[model samples]
Target: MSTESVQGGGNDPAIEVTPEAAEEALSLLEGEELDTDEAGLRLFVQQGGCAGLSYGMRFDTEPEPDDLVVEHHGLRVFVDPASRNYIGGSKLDYESGLQAAGFHVENPNVVSECGCGESFRT
Candidate 1:
């Protein structure tokens, strides 16, 4: 595993990922052909979903200066500091089955989630 310090800007806060969560994210990326050479996951939070906040995840090659970069199991995960408050203690896991296969976040700050699981409210 590797670790990188993030440069701060604006109101960018600090975000941390647990070893278990990082490992799980890396395992899920294995065997998949990523479009980027960096081989890492980028996490972000957006607005306008049914629950007011939506989570986004993708494989990324570049990270913004204000992004918190965490590495585990040869994978790099990036998250903006502003989104940290909502997901600070969240656990990321890969779930696969007949219905769905994706990265799920167990965010403690999430008070309500939409039926489709695309968004949440704190």
Candidate 2:
């Protein structure tokens, strides 16, 4: 229900962070005693999944020089150039339910995902 648009560092891909995700990420960052102004969630794609690519997320003290920086709802997200190719136009959301509760990336670039729903192929 919360709509928050991201401002990208360049004309590259843009990611939308839902209000829920922003709140949760900011809370986590604060819990870790990180600098909210500089620290951010690093989203990246790595090889190895059955579908050929898997998404990864972690907290970084700061973004790399070439990383794509985006800010939304007081939360900062950093994406490397290589990972941007697979996650552009994506929506980062947080889902809380009895079955699963976590940050999920609804990626538009995915053509198919593995049965487990952990990996995807473009």
Most TM-score-accurate candidate: 2
Model 2, 51-110: lDDT tens digits are 999999999999898888888888889999899889988999999999989999999999
CA lDDT, candidate 2, residue 105: 95
Clashing pairs in 2: none
For model 1, where is the 10-residue window of minimal lDDT?
A: 6-15
Each model's RMSD to truth, in Å?
4.1, 2.2
TM-score of 2: 0.92
| Regions more than 4 Å wrong, model 1 | 1-39
Instruction: Give the whole-model CA lDDT for all candidates, comma-separated.
Output: 0.68, 0.89
Candidate 2 runs further than 4 Å off: 1-9
Query: Against the correct fold, how does model 1 do in TM-score?
Result: 0.69
**37-75 per-residue lDDT for model 1 (tens digits):** 365788878886888999888776667777766554455
